[model samples]
Target: MLSQPETSEALSGGSTGRALVIHPVSKTPPGRVSNQVASRSTGARLDEAVGLARAIRLDVIRAEVASVSRPRPSSFLGSGTVENFAELISEYEIGLAIIDAALSPVQQRNLERRWQAKVIDRTGLILEIFGERARTHEGRLQVELAALTYQRSRLVRSWTHLERQRGGFGFLGGPGESQLEIDRRLIGERIARLKRDLDATRRTRALHRKARRRVPYPVVALVGYTNAGKSTLFNQLTRSSVTAGDMLFATLDPTMRRLGLPSGRQVILSDTVGFISDLPTHLVAAFRATLEEVTEADIIVHVRDAHHPDSEAQRSDVLNVLADLGLDQPTEDGLIEAMNKIDLLDPTTRLGIAQQRLRNSQNVALSAVTGEGCDGLIEMIDRRLESASRVVRLDVPLTDGKTLAWIYQRGEVLGRRDDNEAAHISARLPEEDIARLRHRQRLH
Candidate 1:
């Protein structure tokens, strides 16, 4: 919830101090929107919540899992549970309470009023983290847009104390607008401006993508769950010093670098923001400009933390995000799974993973930390990109040196023969390069 008082402090701009992380495990039946996540233990979820707290440099004084058989409308937690945590908050001098679930705006207000402390839910916590981690102008813009959108929904939490209507404007009607209406109108205007700026940014990105298409470099995008060693693998493959830490969302902005594959093909490798379970829709929409890079990619590499117990579940989450991005056919589009963190696995499990990779042409087990099997991943990438290319025969006039040079520069020559009037060449080229060649021929 967003408010001018301590509630605002919790959701938007909380200070770093003693914090209590709580995960409410729901016993609700399947197919309902509950706090329970599949393929992960309650302890693991609580631990992840704690990690999220620490990512923002918060000193986590206590971490606990509260079981909720039934949710209370006011506080989301039962009275007994809320009272118990209130005591715990006081005992630990907790300044903030982090709830690892989505809370209604009313529920958030009620909780804060009861505990007498700042309370933040999962969405707010994630927004806060993104707000702090954003560095680029576009990133800052997107974060602010998302934050404002989120705040707009919870305006009821603010100005509740100012129920009395202020005097009307001079020469205006008798009734005056409420503070909530004023804040809503202001937020709506800001959101409109943000949309305009983001639209321009989106256009600029489309132009950049168009320019890259002209260069005809195949783009390979890396995607996976948060803290799944994507940045580590990016650094290992590109040798660029991106911040690769053992924390969620270490890389927020999209990063790209030129990578030379084993087949001597130069491809643009993009490292994108990692996906998480139950990611906020506001965030997904805000980062659409950044995610368009993935949709336009020539190939996608799904990096996975193979050692994590929830690795499979993490894969599902990433795939779901990709599907939401209109990439429902990721596997059919030739997805490559790079099973990272093999170094952490025991010898027997690692050997099994290696064997499995041999059976599955799309899987590659590797350790980015130790540079193990990374070459194999690169080789796999080369093969996947190679498979995406087509062999085409072109007849170039002897005097058309420009066309001949363009083909040779952008494609691999398979077979060539020179005649008196023209050169008949067979070459493998990417679809984009092929289209360009055809367009040039049509113009001639």
Candidate 2:
């Protein structure tokens, strides 16, 4: 058992708050190297659990490592450990107990009875955080759907008294008799309605995406670990004041702005919600519609906080998520790494790493807070876009002025000449749109 000091303050409405964290550790035999590795990994996970609890301002009163018992069925600490935890709860007056693992509804209910407090599993805590952080309608809806799905699984706990309720209606009866059943049915209907609403929203978003594609501006999406300075870099690049806080999940909505690159080419820059280690699978599934922005982007900018101790691990985590989304394939040649927060490092170290990364032709390094190396980043983007584009030289007859005007509007024309019979035009367009333009020219 490990105890950390608790601050004396009101948790909510002057109610004292204290929480206990329970982590189950496997007691595998010492000879196996695999078990050793597993134990080491479990220790690291416990540390992260503590850090997360502290980040959320939870008053952690005690942390315990209980040896696993009945692993096949219970997958949690043994009965003796539960008894000891119950004793600790009585002694410390804990209002909540956070189990750093997924729990079945029966396990959750049993634990709550033993501790006489609200029991929250790792998934529940993350859902609560997301619910609090969601700022946009789509974000809130996604979170709500995920929460409802998770809640549906725990409906067993919710209707524990079903066996005791003698019914006159065979589980679906009289007007007011089956109140619990009615409530459950109503909830099921609501969940169905929400799913329909979300489907409609997805369609609307698809139409909006089509409209953006018609504008023909390349989109650059910023992606990285939470608190990796994505929103900060977005603000620095676009000069728009979006919420850039040090807290996790600060930017829930995808924000887009037109950014003028170094070559004077305008592109759309999108700042999306950040990724995290062990992000809930349900949350990922729920947010896939919004995260498709990354897949649609012409360039994916991976921003990283160079100052954090676990920056490398954070990078790996972000890459794992990207790989899961199929955005880490070698075919995705549009990935750019942006190592941010160089200003927080010592000047010599910052310059050395920046120079090294630049030399390796990996990506750009910049400090979003101080506007350092931002010009180089923009220049790199412009260069990549220019390289991927194709230049077309077309001589359209002056009789078709509309074609020339459309060309000027759709692409960057480097030169235009008027001849007695035709208008000679040299312009650059994205490779994908070149064929369309060629067909339109043939029609003219």
Candidate 3:
């Protein structure tokens, strides 16, 4: 079990801190309910929000639902709701207000002033989790980039004191001190440096990818909503003890391991950071390098918690993130859906849905924890890989022994026969390598 910080002070670098959760729900119109209405179970959302807050060690004194407000403004609650929140803040002596929704900097600042507390929106909370969970240098860089991007908009809040003027001598009393200005300038420089460093990291990652390609193994990436059992599935598939938990954003660094499919084909499977709704744009931008794994994947396994009430919504959110990563094109045919955690569902329902999906030529459903249906999933992956491969039958001249040797070394030779004039070879090769071989055959 992941340990929670004993107090907010231990987590946030201070003792005088408390958080109030504000989730503004808009009332539906008289006749029709807009699809955009907040329809998620308030209890579930609150549970998740509280879990996230606790993970960050925030001292959440009180968590409540502010009044449902209209025209949402994508930020602070309505003026009236803000007023109520102000009163609650005073009553609770809250030091921070954590809005469950994404908040614009303008609205964030306004809310902070009204509540007389620091305001951390959903995006900031996620970034804080990433900052804590990132372990690798590349992962750290990605998190830092995302955090900086998120902070850029809120710089005004962080440096508000910069606007104040210090008491100075008539001409130049030792130059008025401006802590906020200094901090802002320092942060700006750090952002620039991080960008440069990330650029280098991206290049390093590119080189690593090139090396992997030379080994010629297919790459399978696991992607899904936060707490959708990605790490569990990854651990199940790879037998590697990566951190797995029920909390949101439990795994931050992308983990890769070699997996042998049922057909005896080996491929690299990577577990990436989980996606979430209303993810901050800066966080996405900063984590672009980490997500690039998805973009470059030979196959994408979209894992989801099959028993979750919001499974469909969670699927939508995962796809939205994939779209943002430029993997939304119709040409992305290698995508597979893994309805994970089937053990949590009724046996009949799980089997029925799995059978239905299989019959429809869709992907697989399995419980990553119990290992149920795992073999079928592996077989499905193998079939997909086989379908995408190119089959080649080469008749090489007996004198061209080097070519025959090369073919044997580079391809998965299915059959071979020696003839007086040539050696007939049947093999399965990657589409690109097959094309190159055909071009070379014609040239020779």
lDDT tens digits, residues 291-367, model 3?
89789888888888888877777788888888988877524358778888888899787877768795766568888
Q: What's each prediction's TM-score?
A: 0.84, 0.78, 0.80
Q: Per-residue lDDT tens digits of candidate 1, residues 1-444?
A: 334333333432323357899999877777777644568878778888898888877799899999898778889999999999999987777768889999888898788778777788888788777876777889988987887787777775332312323211110101222234337888799889999999999999999887776566788999999999999999999999988899988989889999998777789999998899889998899999999999999889999999988888888889899998999877644688999999999999898998998798889999899999999889888888887798898999999988887777677677889999999999888788788888867222
Ranking by TM-score: 1, 3, 2
Q: What is the lDDT of residue 409 in candidate 3?
A: 55
Task: Give me the runs in candidate 1 sitting further than 4 Å from their true place.
Answer: 1-16, 28-37, 156-182, 396-427, 431-444
Model 3 stretches astray by more than 4 angstroms: 1-17, 31-43, 59-61, 67-75, 157-185, 330-333, 395-426, 431-436, 439-444
TM-score of 3: 0.80
**Candidate 1 local lDDT, residue 70:** 78
What C-alpha lDDT do the candidate models reach, one value each? 0.80, 0.71, 0.72
Which residue pairs in candidate 1 have backbone atoms (N, alpha carbon, C) closer than 3 angstroms, thus clashing?
none
* Evaluation by TM-score, superior candidate among 2 and 3: 3
Residue 258 lDDT, candidate 1, scale 0-100: 96
Q: Per model, state how many residue pairs clash.
A: 0, 0, 1
Candidate 3: the clashing residue pairs are 9-14
